[model samples]
Target: MRQMGRTNRARYLATFLLGYALSGLLTGTWTSVETLMDYFKYKPRILCVESKTKPYFAICPFHKEEDLLVSGSIRDTGIWDSDLTHLLKVALSLYKEAMLVDLGAFIGYFTLYAGALHHDVLAVEPSNSSFKRLRQGLLLNDFSATIKILNKAVSNKRSYVHMGKNQKLNLGKMHVNSEKDTDDRENALKNEMIETVTMNDLLEYIHVKQAIIKIDIEGYECKAMEMSTAFFKEVFVPFIFMEWLIIRTNMNSNETACTWTDAKRLVDYLTGLGYTPFAYHPVFTLLDPSAVLDWEIDNIFWQHKNAKSLLPYINLLRKVGPKYFDKMDQNQV
Candidate 1:
């Protein structure tokens, strides 16, 4: 009986291995064929891909495979990066004529969306590859004359800075002062130094009467706020969309991440400038001034005191449900 049991187990193991090998081979064959098809479909030059937000393109000569995958995913799949589509539609509708300022505007997703809506747009991007793609996307959509593109990192200081070392996977990861002390200097990724500018510097060139700003500069929100306080005081920016990433973690060090203290300071600074903080989870949920001190979330929208008239629009967005925002592809210009 023991001999018979051993024979059954060996047969089962052999069968499992055979099935695994066959499945792997089939998958490899399918992937190769699909990749070849994609190369032919989008070869010679990167093609403009349409998302719910707007049409855009991405290209990285050094990381051609990954770049093509990213661009193709956006083109072929309608479901790529649709999280903010709904919210942006509602927000853009509220202020049709407001200037849209897209900081860290990688590949010009928001910039193109605003331009398509016929709103004057100012887009700032640091990485060389991303900026090139941003320009391509703008021109592809025939929005080059409508939207202004600046290839500079937005930071507290107007000086040149190096991109982070691990940006080979996605150029979007590139940011100012991204090198870690522990990173091996000899083997580290070498990125070109890009020019840096402040929000105030860009504001001088904007001729728009009203403005809305969207900031997603990795973990440099605090530094940006510190630099743009004067601009906030002088300008009546109705809405400010920024990422708030100050949550409690088990990590031993807080040096690399934005802390609760940084969030509180930013909230205080913005509030002092007469802007109210609210959570932007695809719907406009009002946030108490002190709530941001401890609350953990990614996107926060701040409304200026002068823009109290926008409350009705916010309420309308709340009643429309999240689905209403996704069906806005038809609203694209």
Candidate 2:
């Protein structure tokens, strides 16, 4: 009976391994086909291979001579890095000694890119599991020395926080803004406590020359911004981009603080502090403030009033086609 049981267990193990290998092959084959269909050239691709000489690196498609390579899992979103690099090049041209702060540094892909460009970087992430992956990416990309990783959530207050229950990342280190209506979203995840910090404290710790902040804290962007008022006042960060999405009417989540209503208020608040808000389009400049408040999907923003800040992007878009500019003007809120 014991010999028979062992044989059955071995058979089951072999079957499982075969199934896994088959699935992996099938997925890879499908991804290859999809890549060919969506792209005409390898220019949009960023390769990640096992190499001891350099941990991870990417060659700029637009400028082969200006490859901004680093250590990280480029396989996760190499295509996304293309978009990020384009944005970074523009930002760097604006600020000579730029200090980039990525508020929600998930997996550290964008952080590594910014850090590798010789910009001083500070990445703030709260989830231990997420931060683990982020740290690995930073180390793998060899960005450990330049990039400062802070494993804490930024909020309006500086103290220990209860992140509550979150199944999305399987970590309870997510921040909840009690000041807003976030009960439905919090309840969905289950509630627990986690560590927290304030923006003022973080800024004071990492004193830098210039800064550009990307705040994508899911929904806690409002609290993060409110807490970092000191930094906003002191530093002239030319850009402050956040994710604003229109969701179901029933979802009372603060995670969409960059939505139409919240973005209007936030943009107004920032501009009130002497910052000019500009709506960013991939093709051309649409300097309407209300357009951001009018968006139902995600959008980017330039906090400073420099009209030239978006000229290159605008020209790039216009070169694509006139329809891009027409649609942009039509979408203005």
Which candidate has the top score in TM-score? 1
Model 1, stretches more than 4 Å misplaced? 1-42, 53-73, 79-83, 167-170, 178-191, 246-254, 257-259, 282-284, 291-293, 308-333
Error of 2 at 237 (Å): 0.5
| Residue 111 of model 2, lDDT score | 72
Please provide the root mean square deviation of candidate 2 (C-alpha atoms, Å): 15.1
Evaluate residue 169 in candidate 2 and report its C-alpha lDDT on the 0 to 100 scale.
Answer: 27
Cα-based lDDT at residue 242, candidate 2: 60
lDDT of 2 at 113: 62
Candidate 2 per-residue lDDT, tens place, 188-232, comes to 335543456777777665677578887767666656667677787
Runs in model 2 deviating more than 4 A are 1-77, 164-192, 246-263, 279-287, 290-293, 306-308, 317-333
Writing each residue's lDDT as its tens digit, candidate 1 over 212-245 gives 8888787777767778856665555888877664
The global Cα lDDT (0 to 1) of model 2 is: 0.52
Positional deviation of 163 in candidate 2, in angstroms? 3.5
